[model samples]
Target: MKLALSALGLAVLTGCAAVSPQQGVDRANDEAAGFTQGALNLARTQQERDDRAQKTQTLLSAPVGQKEAVQLALANSAALQALLAQGWVDAAGAAQLGRVANPVFSFERMSSGGSLDLGRALSFGLLDLLTLPARQGIATRRIEEAQLRLTGDVVDQVTAVRQAWVRAVAAQQTASYAQQVYQSAEAGAELARRMRAAGNFNRIDRAREQSFYADAATRLATARHQATASREELVRLLGLDEAQAGALRLPERLPDLPKQALEPQAVASLATRARLDIRLAQSALDSASKAQGLGVVTSFTDIELTGRRNTAFDADGTRSNARGWEIAVALPIFDWGGMQRAAMNGRTLAAANQLEATVRAAGSSLRQSYSAYRTSYDIARHYRDEVVPLRKLISDENQLRYNGMLIGVFELLADARDQVGTVLAALDAQQQFWLADAALQASVVGRPGGATVASPAAAPAESASAGH
Candidate 1:
């Protein structure tokens, strides 16, 4: 059954992903057919993804002095450090497991001459016979589990940094807009106060203009504070100290969000096909099953080989040599069959429970992720299509009314404030959509919208890991 599942794992729940792009799926299949070639294809795909990101950066207007932040994050991020340690542990474990246990030997001696009595001794030269294999299997599984977890962590951190970058840029733009509105409001308020003092207008006009200026000032201050906080967050995430942060430049632009969006079913399929947490649990079950087999063998089989040496003596003090070999097995009678069975049963049960838990947790997470990603996508789309356009129309109308003197200067300033607010809100909506995108990609197997990664149970999912 395990072997059958192993084959089925690579095939997916229905033997293939229901939502994968045909070209990428075909490419994955081709890679599956040839080990080295498959690796080459993956490498090529990754390089292309990197190249695209680099190109995209040139078009975006990011902050200045962000280099120090990047350098710091690369050096001090706890997530990255933990990942590196896991990789080293995995390497040592693999080496130990792959290596063979040294052979065993036994020595024998005769107690007396002319007597068949022999001396028996027991010693284990290959104590590694058990520890090595057991430790190796555990290590290999650890590597897979670690790699999967680390991949998700790194992706999460990257997404976080990108989101902060997006927000920081938006905040700066908002502050710039707010200041513009404030300047116009101040001018209008002064004009209205003069007109009221000269008996040309009522106090209402002057008061409204002053209110507009106050509102713009509040918003501008808020925007400045937000930008500052976001900048600091980016720097901290990049692992820089305060001094290094001071030397950093803000990003010039943010990476574009994945142009393509996944449907709910696609995200669900992705979670199942590529989620490493689930794979790690499945591998643990396999390791447990293997351990049960070893336990069963140990409990039943008392395997031993013995040797003896003896000398027959005439009435003389000289001894003649004799040697013999004997193989022995212990007959089970009072030994703990129930205890062995109990232990094996527990291990097997735990394995089943673990796999079950992982599948359930992954399914639940997928459902939540798909919904959030879809919601963000739809909201951002709505802002772009409906809200932003309406705000712009309002602004244009306000401008015309001001030109015709049908509306006062305060009314025009009000429209300007609203337009700036709408743009900032739209920007936030869009950035959130990208954050959701990062999460879904982390759940999947690679950078967003590029390739299909499939986890096959072909020989235990643990064997299908990278940097392990």
Candidate 2:
């Protein structure tokens, strides 16, 4: 009896202690910061929320870099906050499931012929108390799964914010060049019109120049809209209010490509170490296995232990007290829980299969993301080292020729326009490289976030002589 009472005391102590979700959230935030170089947090109080808002305001007060953009999104995004809050709730619920149910109490009173009786009883689920340890293990696994999921989600969100900032800044850069191209086209068209009036240019030639101007105008309009759209997309991701949006700014261009690309072996190693999806699957499998074992006993039978006491009075003024204990067990004579066991078996099998699938997919995803990262880096470098420089050389030569009266001004203007176009293409390549960089970082942490690299825009084919 002493041993049994000691065991019950231990179980009650284990079950009565409240579980906190903050620990899991803090672990996830720390892991995410290690992987993504950004911090994540849950603002559970008004003070925390206010502090985050202040930080966001400070970040938005200037031209935000890619890292700053990620920080801003982490601090300000309502959707991300909601996800964190939900994760906490899920973890708390899982903890609740690990605890034993509350004990039940009952009372009764009866009176007849000057006789009175009083009774009291207390009951609790014996099976739940006995299975508390196994249930707690399952709950722990569930909490671990939630933390990994939260880490993966933070990776995804930070990657998205980084990529969006890249596109927005790149769009703005492209739009500026497009405006330059438009101005050059307008000047060339005006010159051709003047030359046509002076009978120095043919009607066909002037029409061609006018056509180029029209195309340039249309391109400029498209570029402007693209810039606005991409900027708004970033704004939404950062969860900026109207006042914050007004203060938000971005760098004029994407950052330069890194000197060296990430080695595939290193990336693969990191993916293997930090793959949250695989960890989550493993947790699920473990939980399923434990639950399956627990179901074997629980599904077939349930036991409730009750302690009772009563007092009775007779009409002759004699009183008596009675004390006893009752045990209630669900009889499994009719149903043997065969279907429940089968379901548990099926769940275990599914969990095992899912774990295998996640493990297999992790390698493939990492490889694909690395490939995109390397390819985009190469393309962007090529544009920076070869294409833009070549265009610049051609433009410089054309300018010299025009100064020496060996080339027409129209030729110089057209060369300048083509140079701007080439720079625009290079800007686009840089953007793709940065985006791929962000995606690869996410993939390394086991959350593959981006798809394919964007193709570079084609340069204009018509030379300056075509308008002549």
- Highest lDDT, which number? 2
User: Quick one: best TM-score, which candidate?
Assistant: 2
Candidate 2 residue-wise lDDT, 1-468, digit = tens: 854695588577566434565665677666776544546777889999999999998897889998888888888999888878888877777777688887888999999999999999888898988898888888888777777777777777777888888889999998988898889889899998999999999987788789889988998999999999999999999999998998998888777788888888777666657577888899889989998999999999999999899999998889999999999999999999999999999999999999999899888888888889899899999998998888878888888888999888777776676676577678878888888888888887778764577788876656446444
lDDT of 2 at 397: 87
Q: Model-by-model lDDT, in order?
A: 0.53, 0.83
TM-score of 2: 0.92
RMSD of 1: 14.8
TM-scores vs. true structure, each candidate: 0.60, 0.92
Candidate 1 error regions (>4 Å): 1-79, 90-122, 125-139, 181-212, 241-244, 251-274, 296-348, 360-364, 446-468
In candidate 2, which residue pairs clash? none
